[model samples]
Target chain A: MTLLLAVKALTQENRDFLAQYDIDVVTPDTVTDDQLSEVVISYAWDNTIGNKILSLPNTKLKWIQAQSAGVDYLPLPLLAKRGITVTNASGLKALPIAQTVLGYLLYFARGLNVYATRTHWEPFTDQYLISELPVLVFGTGRIGQQIAHHIKAFGGKVYGVNTSGRPVAGFDETFPITDYQAGLAKAQVVVDGLPGTKNTENFFDDHFFAQFNQLFLFINIGRGTTLNQSALLEAIDDSRVKYAALDVTTPEPLPHDHPLFERPQILLTQHTSWGENINAGRVGGLFRLFEKNVPSFMKDQTFIQNVVDLNKGY
Target chain B: MTLLLAVKALTQENRDFLAQYDIDVVTPDTVTDDQLSEVVISYAWDNTIGNKILSLPNTKLKWIQAQSAGVDYLPLPLLAKRGITVTNASGLKALPIAQTVLGYLLYFARGLNVYATRTHWEPFTDQYLISELPVLVFGTGRIGQQIAHHIKAFGGKVYGVNTSGRPVAGFDETFPITDYQAGLAKAQVVVDGLPGTKNTENFFDDHFFAQFNQLFLFINIGRGTTLNQSALLEAIDDSRVKYAALDVTTPEPLPHDHPLFERPQILLTQHTSWGENINAGRVGGLFRLFEKNVPSFMKDQTFIQNVVDLNKGY
Candidate 1:
């Protein structure tokens, strides 16, 4: 089987690991206008050119192995029409996202805000801090599950949101989206780990936010498109949202004069998630595919880790 | 059951909560040298005068409850002589510390420093972010434990240090001070959450830092005395340490021109970890004692959530 692993850079150590197999490692940029028979795609696919790349090899391409946990960007129609099997690296990103979410949460919960607040001469320096606030996580995917586990360790009561009412580990309670209103109703901190899709878009709009019982600590690390920025801004303006941390913003590289940047309550970090250290794993996976002569998910098009449904655009 | 909640401002609602019992609420200023015998004492006692509150009711006090988790300031000899029961609010600060540690970890792991090194812009942004760094957490107390737990949640290998060699929940490995040599040997991120005792002070001196594998993030959410600032400066100068975030500083208000302030590696934020909100929970602990004769940590004495060995000065 001819296996193709696409990534930015592969380390010598990783290259040696893949040398054991018969695989051709290529850069994402290398997969140009011409499509290959079997290609394992990493996260570096440029949105504008990604679909075109997938369409090039219609009959020959067997599968597309994705390196990201989020499947939203995958060229679903091309893969579907060509019958290209797809899989993803969903589990890997969860640990990192969970860590990132906690960073934002703690930054907010710890009152890091006061660090920048003005005080006379100095502030009241105390030894003991307050209790952990209850967290209501709005997603039970890998990211949510991992986040729940960490929150539980902090002695926090975690309520998770999922499509089904099935119980999830690490969460005190898991309710369906039907009960999402109640879950958010009691949440002191609301985390939107929900993958962005047409259905979930504008999920935290004006009406949705109005349902929050108290001033909410809203964090969006999932996808920017899932948010209704205007509504989120309104929540901030209305005082219903105490703090909003957005790791992903629509049309990123938010204008230097963006209104959100000026809002003291909002913390804007670039969409720095997922793009972290891709070369190592992507390269390693490629090496493994080539040497093992493994019928990679890229060739089979049946087994994928993070597959985005084209119809839903997630 | 008279409780004296010592804080700058204690609320009527909290006062009423304690008043349900027979509590006589008093602020630090209201407690004249006389009415000491009739009440129990509690204070936002991390300040310089935390222990002096004990002297007001030097003889009559049953318990010296502290609104702080660390009783480093409690006069050990005095409390010991009077047999004044001292208990603290240890776990309360866990949430914020956990949050702070994770924030720095993200900042450290993701190379947010590169951006921070220059302005918050790019060309620098193209640098890669690595997430798999090992973190060494000193002081396996509640706050430290929480920090370790969250670090692991982010795919970190957590190593810890504490007085006892007991196993902490999230640490992959822990070493008692007797094994300090072994523990410091493997840490990249050294967090100081240790109590500031004579022995603890300057614990992170040259010799201590020389053992680290490579210090990337040096955080002080605990006592500043835990580190020898001079040794730390040298470590930074020689490139042994990368970043230092001091939430608590020695001789705080650190003289604007202190070596640490201007250093690109160190981020100073006064002593503001527990400064999020001075809500009722903080001052209420002391009031709880005064109102109902309940100690902050009586049920779990030996390792009361916030137990401190005053003789050790932390």
Candidate 2:
């Protein structure tokens, strides 16, 4: 069987790992259209070249492993119709993202943001204890659960939102997406960890933000499409939202002269939450997931682990 | 007995609490010079009026309760000569100060500082995992122990510096001030929580900073007199110190155009670490200490609890 590697770059360690398997791993540029059809597996990344390969008529392709957790840009309908198996590197970036969330919470609670922008020596008067604040997380996946775990360690109450309201391990309480109003009302801090999908796009619109009664902090480490940026700005301007820490924003690289950069109440990180010494680990996670599923595929054409639901679009 | 209150302002609750006591409480301005000599106790803040009262010929003043943790600015020699019993509000500001230290650590570990000053969209690559970092705290007092406790909770290794190398509760190891070289050698993050004293002033000088072999973060929530600001700037400029989070700096307001303000590597907080909603609790702690010491003074002229050693100047 042949596996096409669609990632722009792969470390030597990862290349060696692929060499150990009984498959011919080749980059998309090296393989012709006829050879692409013969490929039974692919390690995909979000790029023009990768999408072009996926768009091709590859009848024998059994599975495509995504190097990212969010697969919103992928052709879900086409993949579903062709009966292609899909897996994602979901839990690989959990620790770094969770660390960033905790950083935002502490930043507000300790008044670091106020001090950072201060030109004079006036101390901030409005500061609350982190242990007393309640947090509401908008997803219950690996990333959200890890965030909940860290916040709970600091003695904060955590409420989770998910499709089924299934009890996630670290949350104190779980609420279905349909019944998250109570959680939203009491939350002093709200975290958006939902993936970018048609269902999640503009989920945090003006109406969704209006549910919050008190001044609270809003942090989005999820997809930028999940948030309505205009509504967020209005919330901040009207003092409904006291502060915002956005790791993801629309039109990322944010057009350099964007107005968001001038707002002292907002902290924009340019979608770099999953950073630091995790690049090597990310590739290692993808290879491990691929390796685990390969035995099942060889035996009975069955792929397991991190399989994405086509309709849910996660 | 007359007890002069020298604080700048008193809340209604605090005034009511003092009214409940048998002693006549009077502000510094309200107390006459003749009445001042008759006053046997005082609850003092660090101010010109408070210092003037201390410098006056108050032969009858037996005990003074300092409303702040640091009593370095008081006339220690004069107080000792007069044999006046002095008590400070130590441990009262512990929680807030420790929270600020954790904020600094998380700020650097999660790359919030880099994002705060960025004009472009380049992500920081030098981020570190907080749990893997080693922290060295210079003081075994209430504030230092609390900082150690929070850092340890996050899975970081904590080492303490003290006069006797005595084992502190939350620290994994202890090193005396005389033998802190080994501790400094291995510290990835260093916190100065040492009280301001003649021995400690300018302790973090150029020679002291040169001992560090790797990149490290230096946080000063301790007295500003303990740090040589010029040397700190030099270290940062030379890359010996990767970053600095100074909640306290010499010449308190730090002069608007001080070079430290221009350095992005240093986060100047203008001595506001013990801020937030902890003021009410601070007054309560002082009252509790004063109330406990009063009974002993009334019975046998003995005062205990947070008694400052004049020779030590803390």
Candidate 3:
């Protein structure tokens, strides 16, 4: 029987389907070294188990089904050198992540943050209506498009930024990465959803924030490496940014005394943007994607869904 | 000059427009009793001034342009008996109020409430997406329809309740106020946008909450008189209601020690749903409505826009 390493548990239905393909599933914790060496497919993720498999001298692993959209944490170069195929659960998280971005926006816009801590009833300061606010999202991928779609639902203007100034279906205007400064003048809210990559490193630096013509709410649901924390702090200090909602930080699990936590204007969602219906959204979505890829994998050991380009590291 | 009593300050433009008709605006504080008795029109609201004007024997107050949608505080029956024409800023607040309703929904659904108080990183419990949830809004007028419109934008199902089970433009389903229980089963969030009236008093009491089939979020951007506070507390205690965001509590400025403030599940927004762009929204909208009605009032002492049915007390 072909051994399949599942770092995460599979439903009984999935196990039964894998059995039909003459593949026996084994978990990293319980699987023998002998069984591990013969594993040809890995589902979900576990850093230690993944490194163990990669370090194996005679490993048979041919494909990996990543449980997340961002593959920054994965060893992309090693996977590419070994000529292994990688598939990701990209669009599955778009709904919840996009919903979370709205959550961050509404938190400040509606004064939920202030109301949460207040013991007395006070009239709010000037508040905003999404319909009257213009939002600029820094990536036009599934996640960014979903954010744009939600913003559009509120009748708010949504501007999208991508590698090229190619227009996407939902955005009112599209700007290329190099020309995004032009769209910054009227934006009351800016969101970062760019994936972590060499080109995106520290994309939202001081120079980027300096062009804003008005106070804006900044939200980051993308990789933390794409933002320069010091520059964001400077923007907040200089009053160029009114509030910052960070769901992704440079280090996962930001330390207890981190400076980001000190700012009253900064809200740290702690990288829980993909939290809504996680088990069902991630696992179920991955299983379906894997199910579709199984037939193709069996026929030619390749993918027909969410194939990641190792060079681009999406 | 025709005396016009304005309880609030008007913009220079609004003052200039009113001046075009040879009308001089006077604030409640500055208007003399002689001027008050001769006042033929009033802009905005002040309980003291309204009652004072209403009490004048043989007064010439022909009409009032109210600054808000709800006129419960105004003596409606007295106004009707006195032959005073009333026009309210109803649809003008629908956009901000609707946006606020969405803010309240997203607050609980995306764990903003939890994250707001937390200092450390924690994986969220099962959160929600508006798309997967069903929302029921009572009172399918401009405000309720706006709420439904915003919910529909997120791809969620919105059920609206009105006096009759008549279909409205945006709701997925319409339930008559008398038959709203039929739509209660699937609703994950319930909003009260019903205006303050005799029939609406204590509308969201124990019996109404008892009919809910699932754990739901309750929001009230409507008049606080419509909700029974004790019953809401009970609902929150029993877990039938997960969270409650009250923009309008039973009494404005709920006492610091009010029982409603004791519950962590309840968020008091202090009747600020109409807060977005207030100066412009209320004053500008009222001025425009008053502007459209000015010529009619000058000629026949009647209105052409937002004429309130004093008997209905909206």
Candidate 4:
């Protein structure tokens, strides 16, 4: 039996992440139908080919571990029919996403970008005190919670929204996904960390963007589909959202000709938030589980801690 | 009969902040000495005529308030000799400084700038996790303690150096400011937030920056004189320190010829971190001491909260 690590590309760190175990690794295109006895799949978010290839595999494909957290784009139907075990590198990316969101918030809240271009390096003006500013986090998952914690530490008021509406530890307020409008009204800086799912597709449309008053900074560390690009563009035109910090976009590697590329208010980051100290090493705990043939330190937990329920879709 | 507000150049917001009360505002350059008894006195850090004008008899300066936290540059001896009440806008700037320090740690500990310039938008490989990263924070004052809270929240191993070495609430490891060399060995990113005084000047010299095995980031939110610019530039050359975020620089409004301005690794901010909204509508708390003969919030205390110990040179 052979083990296949089917990823678009592997970094030295990614290889090191798998090296502890004796699994053989290959790209998705190289996996033969017969060699699926034990396959571990990995792909960047847009690796549609990897999804299709896994669906064509036999029962030997025991587990389909996604290289990313979002699985809506994965061929879920085929995996469900085959009863294949799927794990995602979800929580592993939480730290980076949280850091990125915090960075976006700091850049604005602390006004780093505003002062960066000035010849007079001291901010005599252009200061918006954080303690008075309001921040709304769209998702209360690991990333959202971490961001909320940092915001709270800064003396800013923090509000969060989650599917369950359960209280997050540090947020001043929390609401269910249903009270989105109320939450939006209370926060000037709206941050999106919600997972991309059917329930949240195009969640930030014209109506949502319009509800927000002007001069707010819109940040997306979550999947890009949550925002209606057209609506966001119009809002930018209308000066509703004064700035946009995008880490993930509806389409990866935004085309050079895209108008969004030229917008001064928008600061685009290639979806590389999760790459620092690349997360390949994070899966070492999983390898230790494989070696022991045991449930792991936490017992059958997802590669990242939180398990997203596929039935309702995260 | 006249009143004066001896404040820095008044912007619309500053004017609005003071206009709430009925005091007419005037600068040293605008006032005649004979009418001083009818006016309040305030001064920005760079008020060139502060010493010359305040020396006038019958300037009748009812009170002297400083727009700066550090009043050493002012003709303090002469003002004190005149029995003029002096106070500073210090606490008002803590939030912005604390916020900037937090950004420096999170961004550097997480390698944000590195990934931004990378060709592969995918993450770079890494072996160890951030849990292994060690961060040292200097100064345990209002801003420093706030930073420690954030560092610990993010799972960082935090060590701090303060004057007393007394255990701070959030720091896991602390050493007296004198014993920092041993602690510096463990710090990948050392944040300098100590106020400038005799003991603290040129604190980040060649010997200080040379301790780090890995290139790290340095954040300065305190006075710029505290960090020897010559030493930090040397660190950049030796690759001991990778980048720096300086909210204050020695001789602020850093000269155009300053080496820091030309270095991509250096982030020199205008000394404006403390003036944002936190100070707004709050300074009058001190103003009430005499303007209306109202007792201070800390009326019985020997010193106002955050009052600098001039002997200690803060």
TM-score of every candidate: 0.76, 0.91, 0.94, 0.79
lDDT per residue (tens digit) for residues A12-101 in model 2: 766665566556666766777677667667776645655666667645766778877888767888889888878887887787788888
Q: For every model in order, what is the number of clashing pairs?
A: 21, 0, 1, 11
lDDT of 3 by residue, B246-286 (tens): 99986788888888877878888888787664566666776
Error of 2 at B126 (Å): 3.3
Which model scores highest in lDDT?
3
**Which clashing pairs does model 3 show?**
B247-B271
Candidate 2 lDDT over B51-128, as tens digits, reads 666667645777778877888877878889888878888887787788889889888888898887676677676676
| Better model by DockQ: candidate 1 vs candidate 4 | 4
Local error of candidate 4 at residue B31 (angstroms): 5.4
- DockQ for every prediction shown: 0.26, 0.51, 0.64, 0.33
lDDT (Cα atoms) of all candidates against the true structure: 0.63, 0.80, 0.85, 0.64
Interface RMSD of each: 5.0, 2.1, 1.5, 4.3
- Sort all candidates by DockQ, best to worst: 3, 2, 4, 1
Ranked by TM-score, top first: 3, 2, 4, 1
**RMSD value for candidate 1:** 5.7
Across B1-314, the per-residue lDDT of candidate 4 in tens digits comes to: 13655545555654454555544677656666555445544434344555545655556553455555566565555665665555555554555666677655555554544443343334433322345567788887667777777667667788889877888888888889889886787877778877667778888887877776655678887677788889888888777787788877878667777788777677666765554555534444334322332123123323344444445545
TM-scores for chain B, listed for all candidates: 0.82, 0.93, 0.96, 0.76
RMSD in order of candidates: 5.7, 2.9, 2.3, 5.7
Mind sharing the TM-score for model 3?
0.94
Q: Residue A126: error of model 2 in Å?
A: 3.5
